[model samples]
Target: MTSAPAARASMDAGRALPPPVLVVSIVSSYLLALHPGTLPRDATTTAVVTSGFAAVGAVVGMLLSRWASRRRPHPDTQTRRVVFGAGVLIAAGGAGLSVWWQSLIRAAVGAPPVGPDWWVAATVAPAAAVAAIVLIPRVTAVIAASAVALAAGLLAPADAGADRGQPSPRTIVVSEFGTLLRGELAAPEFDHPAERLVRSWMHSGGLAARAVIVAVPTGSGWVDQAAVAGFVDRFDGDVRILTLPYADVPSWKAFISDDATATESSITLVRELAKVLANRPAGDRPRLVLYGQSLGAVGADAARVWLEDHHPSLLAETVLTAPPAGTVAQASRTPRIVVANRSDPVVRWSLGSLWRPPAYPDDTVLGGRRVPEVPWLPVVGFLQSSVDLLAALDGPTGVGHRYGTEQARPVSGLPR
Candidate 1:
């Protein structure tokens, strides 16, 4: 049993990562991947998250390994066997816990239970763990993995069907800011989108509609089509919903980097619309209503505040669904209906949530449906809510970020 090659291999093994370290890295990461979030995620999302977490867990495990190595220096063969065996047992328990979590996630989100996708995730778990463990020990590998994760996150298709609803088919005048995604294709882009949109609307007889609903789009130029359809119903099919695409980037990216695009676009469109309305006879002018959701809400509120300052009587009403935490205060004029789901992370999450509890409207103010209470736990709540934001669009209609015709309800008789 003590051949030269076997003895040499045993000596070299001390330089390699400990077996228990690998087990800790993998099991801990996999468990967190299966943890419950506010909304359901697809198999791909789960796999990517697992891979990313595996990388983080491997780093954490290495730190623990370094600390233990200093205390023990070298472990006897029997001790190594005992530690590895115990780690395997713990890993087994973690696997069981992951299965239990899968069941809960499925039941909570009405997703299919333990099918082919589950098996795929199970297979990916070990591979991702091995890859992460192998790559994390080197500095270049660490940087490469981080870059890949960031790219994957940015390129990932927007939270599955984040803009699922389509615009109404009922002769609803659809005027777009010409060439919104122009720069995306390396095409020569032009300016004066507001003037272009106004010209198009005037030519399309939008001015003749009974109501003009200016729909400010989210950062990615998405307006909830269902909400637009609701606007048509509220106006008795006599409304023209206007949308101007601002940027082709995701809402989060636009929210942080170029929120000004939304503000500037909204102001331009609303200002142009106001001038057009002023030229018309008072009796012929259509009622102007402002609508936006999420980042679109931020932009619409900017324009709403501007309208209040410059032309207080121009805007009849404003409807904002799931507006961001601080945007409502900026657009604080009356006749504004803000529909925010109690479960929506977008409405509650902010940097300040780490230390301070988020401010929420009273139960009576929320009205109708509401999600179960989540006890705020300072930093923990902030972290959980941030994770929930990724799945914000995954819940049932009327819950989380998704809204329905209920968003069209009038603001009358509600507390300011």
Candidate 2:
């Protein structure tokens, strides 16, 4: 009895998205944004992240709807009643989550709640959900492929013979030191750098120097110039600082995948230097210090452990700045000083931190100086800490993961 146009209309109506899908998407978006991060996000970032969450939520909602539909083919009235019930529950739950987020944010920052940001998320979530449900795998595929292509081009390792075009940030920093010292500091550019650097140091009469500091570089091969400057200041320009290039990737990537590169490279350099150091008398030998920050600290600590086992007397001191949780070795005889900030996510973030509170180094004199304590709340703490890791470096000199020349200060009463 129905006309063709009416039948087409009925089909279109049937294809319309279920009410619970939109509710789930919006709820999911808000839930993710509820977690407090190290840095409070701006409206733009909040919207973008919420939208991403909404898109994922939309897919999940669609699947959930399919399952529910198969389980119970409800009539129109029953569906409306179910939708109303979900909406009411969502409203009440959202209010509770909002209050919790407000309290955490308030505690982190003195005043001015992140209430407005929630609106940004709320406004963006439903629209993002609708778009995701409509433009799904096609749009996702294109974006993913493009992102992969871009990352591949940027991250691909260059051949040694290939012209890298411009020098990297690490090279610039190292080269700048050479220019500043007027060629007194030799940053080796050629192959067999460990042997070449030691040879250069020896040629420059570094063997006769009062002290030598082996500066373990960050994952990206960046040796902190401040730390080097601090060492120079401490030794009164009689210290020969040495470092070698390792991986050229970001610290996190190197931390996860190529951390062994740092440890092994450090060991190789120290071993070569140790062989040369052995030629001199024990009391006349240069005071050897191992210095590392962040990922560098992880490597340097591991090397320190190795040195303790093999060449114990060669290393005078080990300085580990902001080393990550669970990475420090327990069995080292060398005088080790760990400089960690109270609020440093790097020092606190581990698998165990998900449940148990992080334990600070009892031996560290410089640990936990500033910042109010961030209360730990089971799963919430883990989520916040995970987010905090991204912005750990954004804080001031003494806060979070940012350490200063103070990190290079010699431990009190330690023989330098």
Candidate 1 accuracy as TM-score:
0.68
Once model 1 is optimally superposed onto the true structure by TM-score, how far is the C-alpha of residue 32 displaced, in angstroms? 4.0
Which pairs clash (backbone N, Cα, C closer than 3 Å) in model 2?
none
Q: Which stretches of candidate 2 lie over 4 Å from their true place?
A: 1-29, 73-191, 279-282, 349-383, 412-416
Q: Model 1 segments beyond 4 Å from truth?
A: 1-31, 71-105, 116-209, 248-253, 276-285, 324-331, 341-402, 412-416
Q: Provide TM-scores for the models.
A: 0.68, 0.70
lDDT of 1 by residue, 1-416 (tens): 59999877876764443646555666566556545445555666666666666667776777777787788765655565667667667656765665566666556556667666855665566555556566555764777669889998886646322543432122223435211111111101213666666777676677787777778877666777677667767767766777776776667777778778888778878988888887777777877888888888877878888889887777787888787775556336547877877667778888888898777532213532443444676665676677777777766775567778777666676321
Candidate 2 residues 337-362, lDDT tens each?
88887667878788887888767554
Q: Candidate 2, residue 236: CA error in Å?
A: 3.8
Q: Give the TM-score of candidate 2.
A: 0.70
